[model samples]
Target: MDEGINSSTPAWLTEEFIEAILREDEKTQHLQVARADVQPAVAKGDNFGGLLHRVTAEIYYQNNGNNQEKSELRCIIVKSLPSDDWYREVLDQAGVFKREMRMYKVILPAMYKLLKEKLPGVTIPALTARTYTSSITNETLVLEDLRPLGYRMVDRRQQLDLEHCVVALRALAQFHALSVALNDRDPSLMDHFREGFYTPERRHILSPFLQPTLDTLASAVEKWPEYERFGDKIRQIAATSVDRIIDVVKPKNNSLCVLNHGDFWINNILFRYHPKNGKVLGAKFVDFQVSRYSSPALDLQYFIYTSAKEDVRDKSLRHLLQEYHASLTHTLQLLGCGKYAITFGELEQEMKERAFFGLITACTYLGAVLADPSEVVDLDSNFGEESRKNGGQSPMEKAYAGERFRKIFRKFLIHFENEGLL
Candidate 1:
């Protein structure tokens, strides 16, 4: 509470806005949010990951309408577009900023309402969000900060261990399950979500960044004996990556095209651990900037390839699939949906078929994942003018190269090849 609530507040987070929300409740009539302190929430490695800032508020009041005074603290996180014109344009074209606002304001709330009505006890974490879109190019997302609940991110610089993987998968399954039941209750419930994100506008913006990474990755692997066998296929996959992602976005064979957390990488997940033993107790997701309606397998593949190392993935892949399917089915049934038409086999088939989803994403992002926090390049800087000029390679592309990368990339590719994805 001692932190200064100064004039440094961002334009989007005004005192009137904060007071209106705080006093919206009757109990707050006896109190006032005197001031709000804004703090930087950016991690060292994520200087520009989501352009988020934290707002902490101090509330003051008199007890029993008397002279006795009291105070309390409240906090929320704000996500806004980067200050860069280029970054703002990219996010607007891709509808990334708007899509995330929709996710928090529309999709997540709707899904929660459906679950509450259909299944009594079954629930997931609740997200409290308010959005301010000042213009088409300027947007902000104020979300419930999970840190107050002792939730912390599992290290992204290293692969997740078994407990972390299991907790994340089970939690994701619960979320996916909510989508399943909601969709079954109303087949068109997710029609808006199905808009999909790989539009031509997005592709045009993303291609520059993607192409350079692929070329750099290809160049790095060409000399490595481990990837030499699959280098052409790898390069080909990289070159045509965007189109492949777009093609498979359309649902097939009665797949609900379940709501997918389009970016399910470690950076977007948080866990609350038991204080004494330090074991994971709860998990939740953040950053719906890329959420869309697509085959649930897209999320599954993305999560596995991005988070787990070789052994955990190799030995426990199917088991993880089973756990997810079980949670999904259990949730669907709880909503009184009949005859789970989507079976474990169907999910497995999709996983096998969409193996490249994870392969490409992991190959593209793993380097960034493993990078040293201090050495990590800012997102805007990483994809800045220099990269656009040099055919898409940035310091990020350089980070994506080297021995550690080759080892992890080789394992993922070899696994995909054995599974016939190559």
Candidate 2:
């Protein structure tokens, strides 16, 4: 029996199967296993995909006497759910393990295989191992870590030049086009794979977080008299927008619903530089825990709002949308789905309607939470606990956060006025 295999493996994962997988890797021999201290790592940021507890360690092959033939190997990541009680609750409530297993094991692999077979130049993460231990609360996925490929994570506030945006948009267009082509070629396969992934119910799961944040925003907006006229508009939209957003995305019969990197924000994307010119070579996406079947517009809206800075958001909006449409059209033609995929006009209409979804939600909800100084429970003693308590952001930080919120909000309202859609 493989050291990690047990009867408790989910039905989708079996002991015979796990042993076969471990056998394929002959380089490493298991030595000792230990748990990692995860608190320091957690302090880094709250946004690194899933919530992790302590990290688990698996010590493998080592070499000795002659240094020429020797190497030490170990794999470490925050302990997954199967090993931690805290994470188990999180996985249970979110159903993270089961849902992601389906995505990684079935959907993503199929997509990668198809893309590799058709367009070899396209880049995507290569799946490695998917192992589940019932005893531990979390599932362990050994994947090709892209960090080794010279990809680095970027902060949302970092500004991207036009060239970088264009490259990324082209990649996104190809990704969406691949899905459109797959659906057109075999509608049944697309339906079967995407059925459970895209539903209105997922929105409800997010409501607990959304509703409170909206209420908080509603309170904060009262202080800004300049925004008073728009207050009711924001409130009305915030209250019912979750369901409306979902309704807007519900597909209408083989409409180009693709595998979207559900959280297409800056952090989830990794970028690398070219060796000679030091220019951004390309970007690779990761953290697929939120991967779902939704209109490509969802990803577009998210990428624009979270990835682009204020100037880009304000000045380059139309240009970026046009760029995305062009990329989509080109990729569809390459994949032979041009006839079935959406036209530039249709994409524009959808973007106009749905572009505000992420912006509105983030501003009205996240804005309030981020602006509130009390949210930061701890900081260096130099910052002073009293100053850091309950919406403790510095005045400058709060102002910047507020400005971002208002900018997006004002744009949406002005757009509604111009389009006669409000």
Candidate 3:
């Protein structure tokens, strides 16, 4: 039985569409972008995490602003809606595509401009991108690729090291700090973006992903006698955590809130390292599909818990937390709101409470994240045709059920529970 599932490239990345995005910038007005070779930014057919292809564009433009010579620009990356109809619909209905477009087109520029004007000494790294459509039918976002400059994700399967943590934590601090500055400058500055924050209704998107991961985790933890009860408890929570995760993003009085890059794991980040010595220099954040107005704790907890290598997390969590807060304090000070900096004490309290974000990140994400090549599930089958038929234990469930991921899940559960988080 063949299901006529429609999955292909977005119709809007054509040369004509590319030209219009170029027209958005005053600096590029002198040039016309006719056509370019677009290649998958990660790998062919790999949408990375969010059903969006990370793509790089090779563009040649004729300089007409000065009637000068034409030039080829190689500094751009583009993201487009998945060709898969189901992925498109899910992302669209959940406001994922819209939020990311708004991030690139609206929030990012506003935050950058505010940073430059309000805190001259502050440095914030941003992606230079043009967004075409928030419409799920033809969503497109063009971004500046930083890889040519020697920045990329640390090996995804490898545990992130102290250096990676230091760079990521500090950058996250600055990024969140800027959000505070944006809010302080004008309480309304973030109003537009806040509308895109995750909501309970968006839980529909998680349904396809959750239970299978829970089953996988449950099976993995079965060997650990200590985690025996948690296997069932995790299954229970994983089902309900969709709504719970959204609920956690809501308002809390007295706690300072900022726009969160809701998905703060390693793959969503890029790092620039020193050429001569291989020391990590800085980091840049990408992917704001799930970004929203919420306690900064959401991003902080998600990053440290899910992305840190086990040893790094066990040994350096305290140091990294301090580093994160130090950067936050200084950035807030530069924003002239030192008094409003969430104290390290307050931050810890918040992180403890929001510990589930990391767990959710682990269960919902790490299966696909940590899967071996031979183990990779064809998401199209489970999420597409199969879900439409009768969805139970899926290939995704089986793909993630490997012993390695199970142990990883068990470790996360044990950690959270030890902290009184579960």
Top-scoring candidate (lDDT):
1
- Whichever of 2 and 3 has more TM-score, that candidate is 3
TM-score against truth, every candidate? 0.86, 0.70, 0.84
Candidate 3 overall Cα lDDT vs. reference?
Answer: 0.68
lDDT digits (tens) for residues 301-418 of candidate 2: 7777556665676788788878888888877776666786677788877776665565554553333222323342222221243543554443223422465455555565565546
**Which residue runs of candidate 1 sit more than 4 Å off their true CA positions?**
1-21, 24-31, 47-49, 62-68, 121-138, 225-231, 385-395
Candidate number achieving the greatest TM-score relative to the actual structure: 1
Compute the lDDT of residue 28 as modeled in candidate 1: 52
Q: What is the lDDT of residue 375 in candidate 1?
A: 45
Show the lowest summed lDDT stretch of 10 residues, model 1: 128-137
Which scores better on TM-score, 1 or 2?
1
Could you give me the TM-score of model 3 versus the true structure?
Answer: 0.84
Relative to the true structure, candidate 1 has a C-alpha RMSD (angstroms) of: 3.6
* Models, CA RMSD each: 3.6, 8.0, 4.9
1 or 2, which is superior by lDDT? 1
Q: Lowest summed-lDDT stretch of 10 residues in model 2?
A: 32-41
